[model samples]
Target: MKHTIIFLFVFVFLQKGGLLAQSDGDNFLNNSVKTEHFELLQEFLSIPNDANYPEQITENINWLSDKFNELEFNTAILETEALPLFFAEKLINENLPTVLFYMHFDGQPVDLSKWDQESPYNPVVKMKKGEGWEKVENPDFKNLKEDWRIFARSASDDKGPIAMFLSALQVLQSQGMSPKFNIKVILDSMEEKGSPVLAPAVADHKSVLASDYLVVFDGPMHDSGLPTLLYGVRGITRLRLEVFGPSKPQHSGHFGNYAPNPVFRTAELLASMKDENGKVIIPGFYDGIEIDENAKKIMEAVPDDERGIRKRAGFAKPEQVGGNYQESIQYPSLSVLGIQSGWVGKETRTIVPDKVIVEMDIRTVPETNSNRLIELVRNHIEGQGFTVLD
Candidate 1:
């Protein structure tokens, strides 16, 4: 019996020693992995990711596949009518809950003439020096600084976060540990263009995308520098209104008083939609919103610094739509985004324009009925003695 107890004690001691050794080994590996950044972000940024160009988007897909594959993730290129979605998942444990992470890979198309750099795809690292940035042609651990920014398309907009996430996977791999939960990532390729195929893709790949929770990692930081959790986002819709005038372009001198300038008519129509203080004049447009006492208190408490904002914007006074900027957005707004009349600037012309086009975008909240808002705008326009065209 004494011999049997000795054997059991030896086995237990060895088991405990093994666990401690593994823990120490993992800590050492993790500490050393600080230098491993998964994949060089410069290479990812070097690939043009404009979803409008399929060739550019395809190259990004291949790169995403290779990087995720290195981490032993099951990668799939989910097809859609537009650009394909890059989906990667690592099922570490069947019993663990699944998490779906959403990020976009596409970037806004670059206008080379407008960009200061040779190519938008070629990222430049720079450090801030006073009001301007000093170029850092090449960066290494010795020279890299925290304040240095990467000037490239999609660098901060998304690819930066993606690079960080990939590095996190590498850190876990180095430590010989799996993710606490099953991980799935969906990298959208057409997010800049409003993600047209996203809804259809969701419907078609419902089973593939099933998860306990979804986390979207693309958005701006809170103004207060505090982390924020968003419950919902406002929906957007646009309307283009074109008002025809003369059959053809007429000389402004010849028809200055005789011709009814469509530009002026269009201007009047737009002006009628809103009051002088910038409130939407269309009846019932803001009916759904209720500014309760609690909401007023919250709005009043926020330190928005309206005077500072006005100073930066070079405005002595602001439109009295709301008490402050934060409260203003709570109500639906009508804005004439752009008004096109005759050519100006270097292309100045003395002729009246054939037609005037006004572009508008509406932000919808949960309380607002989109159909009712549309009807109200339509009724207001008709009430102003204007023709309604489909």
Candidate 2:
């Protein structure tokens, strides 16, 4: 699987951090193990692991517990406020450093109407032929094709990686190989639904979950189709700026220009927040983020096809942020997720909206504090001659 390649880089990187044992991923992922891994993935995909349903989540936990138990990992169902977290650890020696692996067993709920297949859980192995996927008959297990995809819910989003990790353990077990460091695996039960119980659980079980490093094993895919090492992920902060106008919706035809539209006020406020080159104009938004020469060299090392990316995205020019795509994300980003002033489409309204609501999600980097960025936004809005209510 493509995700396996991504984990290769992750494993190698974690090895440096003493998270994983010193073993090349290439040597571990043999042909037979990969075949078995695919088989195991099919079984895992068979379980309907939508966290929305308690019963399904129970099944997923049981399956994971059984697998971990089989692998000789001491299994424990760690209790939490919500669904209990599944924990398994193998302590090789007391002196060795502990490396905790963070993984999510729960997947997003699937709508039957969206899939062409009989069921989302029932996976299909298909290969692209003339731009259309054609199911293979008696697929070659000896040599799995990299281009071939296993169509299933959470196949790549997360579950595939879990299967891959389990397969790696199986290979290691078969060869009587043991890691030097103490290994711990924490499987989150409610990660898909924003991990509501995680913080409380972590706080409560600090000693048990404590480790030298936390290795997260989740993501869709890297565009490069190569194992890319990401230094960090941008944290999120939400802001809903409500523009106040008349208490009730006024008749546009009657009031016309006389009635001040909250929509216009909101639009102008949003427009002032960003420049024409897609940079946030709010003071202190990009403060403290000073990319140095070393950062520039690291950014330049990423082999990105800038022209190809532009062609695929159907754009002519790139944003004038930090030279390239990899560099641009290094700075905090401001994105307007959604904005609503009045009803549209079939429910079109012909009146000036009473108030306008704009939702914005700011992607914060380690260089910037979320509170400072929010304060800057509030100050910027106030400077635009508008009263911000919280």
Candidate 3:
């Protein structure tokens, strides 16, 4: 995935006159990816990027600063409450439009026991063999295969794109070429943790971060392995609901019927939020969202393999939220991410749990207000004859 994206970036740059002619650009791209690009990715993937470790994040920032500096980019460390973000800019011409690119360096926590390799930070090359991947001890970069993969945290999530961007710049520099637009980059250091500090930091550095257009180099490529461009993404908000029962757990045999089970209450409240067809039943949840004829035509033009999606996701029928897969995402959705009431499996208990906790998330579109949706959910809870508390 990393190499493929790097090729795409360089190819686009060539078309945009940021590199030599197509013939020369093709040779340069191949050589750079096999050599410089591969080396950069390996070095980057070696860094442990779990945001929980501030020291590790600092190390990544240092490395990033050095790389950008080497490319003659003006770099700065944008300080935030938790951790600092890495910023770099290259102004080709003040009169030209500026394009801001967003990528992340932070990765999720790793479990050593779960990984097949020595460490998740150590990237490994593998090739598909039967039903599993077989490690390639020493990959021959000169003869890399299409199916070969480099496995590492953040390799694709973000760091891969960063390396690709840098590689493209290096190629342009070698060819004495420049882009048509000025460039600004903001790399997040805490993206895996929901980027709690990103909004405030952006507000604080609004002038420096200002740009004519913003391009986020994140998210998966289209399933068809074609170049994809997304115009909009769904905004997210979270909610936690707790149903309280008795102060302490009681033996199920002693008060199974007498003591109120918060689990049942939670179930009832959750059930009211959605119908069997999986559409949110809350009043005004779907308000202000409308798909016109043109939007429908644009959505239907997407070659989404509905049957393939259903088979891969292991579902017989999809929710009737929209006419098809593309139409479904246009509306807001309420999803229950997790629920915990009592122990199960080997930890099963013969007592009624004291409380039930449900964690949910709401994906909103442009027409909806996140705070308003949250209020509607809270009101619905209260309407269910339950006392709601923040």
Candidate 4:
């Protein structure tokens, strides 16, 4: 799938100038997306890129600088309060419009015990075999198949695209072809951490990062396994709710009927925000968001396999927030990312926890404001008789 996307990307660039006939371009691109591209991806995936570690981010930035410089791009390290960002550019002509491409090298933390592979950084090529997958040892890149899968952290989420972008540029350079627009690339080192420093860094380097257009090269390919271009995406805001009860943990046996359990209060508060249908029940949470008939028609036109989605996600029923998958995301969504109270499993204890902490995130559409939605949630909690602390 990665190779297919890369081939299409190169093909589009070649097609712009009518450089090669369809068949010729196909053959050339097939050869271009060969061992070299795979090797680049493998090398990149081998490096641990958890943004929590500044050292790891530095290694990735160094690697990126070297690769971009080798391709005749001038690269710089843009410093931020947290980790620094990487910027590279190739000026074709001063008159040409500058296109800034955004991609991230940082990935989420990995738990080794949860992964089936030896290591998340150690990428492996595998082919599906019935219900399981078998590793393809020393895969013949020349005969790589579209169905062959690469298992690794950040393989698809981001690193794959970065490798593809570089490979595309390499192919163009090999063919003595240059892009019509001046190219600028920005690689984020802390994207996995919600890009806390990205805004300030962009503001600090506004002049240097200025471009006629910005293209974000993140996210998965369409579920249809076809090329997709998204015009806009929902914004995100997070909330942490801490429900308090007794000042200290109390033995359930002693305070069974005396003390209140923070867990129960937390659950009740959360339940009030959403009903059985999975729609936010809080007043004004979805205010100002309305999908007209024209917009609904456009969303319905998407080729979404509702049943396939349910089967893949292992859910029998989906939230009734929207009529279909497309309509659902068009409205703001309130989701509980994680919740914690007392220990369970092997660490279970018969005690009432002092507090219950719930982490949630709200996905906001254009019509909604993140701050307003957050305030709405706070108000909703207060309406349930829970004091919301700053």
lDDT of each: 0.75, 0.80, 0.88, 0.88
Model 4 residue 170 CA deviation (Å) reads 0.9
Expressed as tens digits, the lDDT of each residue in 190-218 for candidate 1 is 98887889989989999999999898878
**lDDT per residue (tens digit) for residues 60-86 in model 3:** 999999999999999999999999999
Better of 1 and 3 by TM-score: 3
Candidate 1: clashing residue pairs, number: 0
Cα deviation in Å at residue 268, candidate 1? 2.8
TM-score of each: 0.80, 0.81, 0.90, 0.96
Clashing pairs in 3: none
Q: Write the per-residue lDDT of candidate 2 for residues 77-193, one digit (tens) a residue.
A: 888877888899988899988899988988888989998677889998888888578876777655667777788998876887788788767766765556767889988888777
Candidate 1 segments exceeding 4 Å error: 1-39, 141-146, 295-326, 335-345
Ordered from best to worst TM-score, the candidate numbers read 4, 3, 2, 1
Superposed Cα deviation of residue 133, candidate 1 (Å)? 2.9
lDDT of 4: 0.88
